[model samples]
Target: MFQRRKVIGVMGSGTQAHRERVIPLARWIAEHGYDLLTGAGNGVMRTAAEAFVAVAGRTGISIGIVPGQATARGYRPRPGYPNPAIELPVFTHLPLSGKQGQELASRNHLNVLSAQALVILPGGEGTRAEAALAARYRRPAILFGAAREFRSFPEAFERLATLEEVCDWLLGVMR
Candidate 1:
């Protein structure tokens, strides 16, 4: 029998928290048969993609929401970097430039409508924006690791603990 895929939005940054939590958690999501969603780029997005691929072995699908328009060309592996666990599905829409400026406002805007639930890891302004958007649409949001304090909506769920806690919460949602 076919099962409905649960697209879990993982909002995080391309920094330390991502190195510690976001990457591993995303891998777990895939191992458990859930699809992973994120803004396509480096840091958390890259880490999650790697982890998902690691867990899925072969049949993983990693979908990315590009800030601007995707090119007719598909994703090309950047030289000297790890290939994504699965193919990169880019949803393009330009918003900013540079490292920090690469923040994709459009991706944040569409996050809630694109997924069943959002799991926010620690991040900067961009991550906070995605979490806020999820709440604005009343989508179920669980804040894992950091970003729990910045949570400003009643619809938001916060659990600052181990990855096991995060997994338990997500599995509960699945059930």
Candidate 2:
């Protein structure tokens, strides 16, 4: 749950395009008065955090549900990937790489639980899983990117490919 600011969960890939798209969206979200929620690893997550900080003038309280233990190695947001915008990062000791899909599933569940809405960018299996979970939860999941990438996912909610459309929805419809 969010405290002072409304929390919007962003699920996107670590890919380059995902980074480009999610970052601005994150800035818009912050400018419009909302907190960012993400996986907090790399690529899209880092960019979002960075953008939010840049626009907000400081890294507001954004949640990063990391997928590992609370150690130096796990806590660090990765080299050359520092997002000063990131404030609080909640680390989960569950090893997402090892066996037991239960851990990853549980973490994803927690990620969805912490947000009121979702913004999905192009990603792989993990991103898809988060999107699917958000839909099943009946939360508004906004898909942003090119039309082809949006086509790949199941169209269960409002789908907007452009930043303007996405922002309009976030301001008018989603609000």
Most lDDT-accurate candidate: 2
lDDT value for model 1: 0.65
lDDT scores for all predictions?
Answer: 0.65, 0.69
Model 2, residue 29: distance off in Å is 1.3
Q: Write the per-residue lDDT of candidate 2 for residues 126-170, one digit (tens) a residue.
A: 677677677777777788777687665767966777888888777
Model 1 Cα lDDT, one tens digit per residue, 5-84: 67887777745345678767887888777787776666777788777777736354777766554357854333322325
Find the candidate with the highest TM-score and give its number.
Answer: 2
TM-score of each: 0.74, 0.78
Model 1 TM-score, all chains together: 0.74
Local error of candidate 1 at residue 77 (angstroms): 14
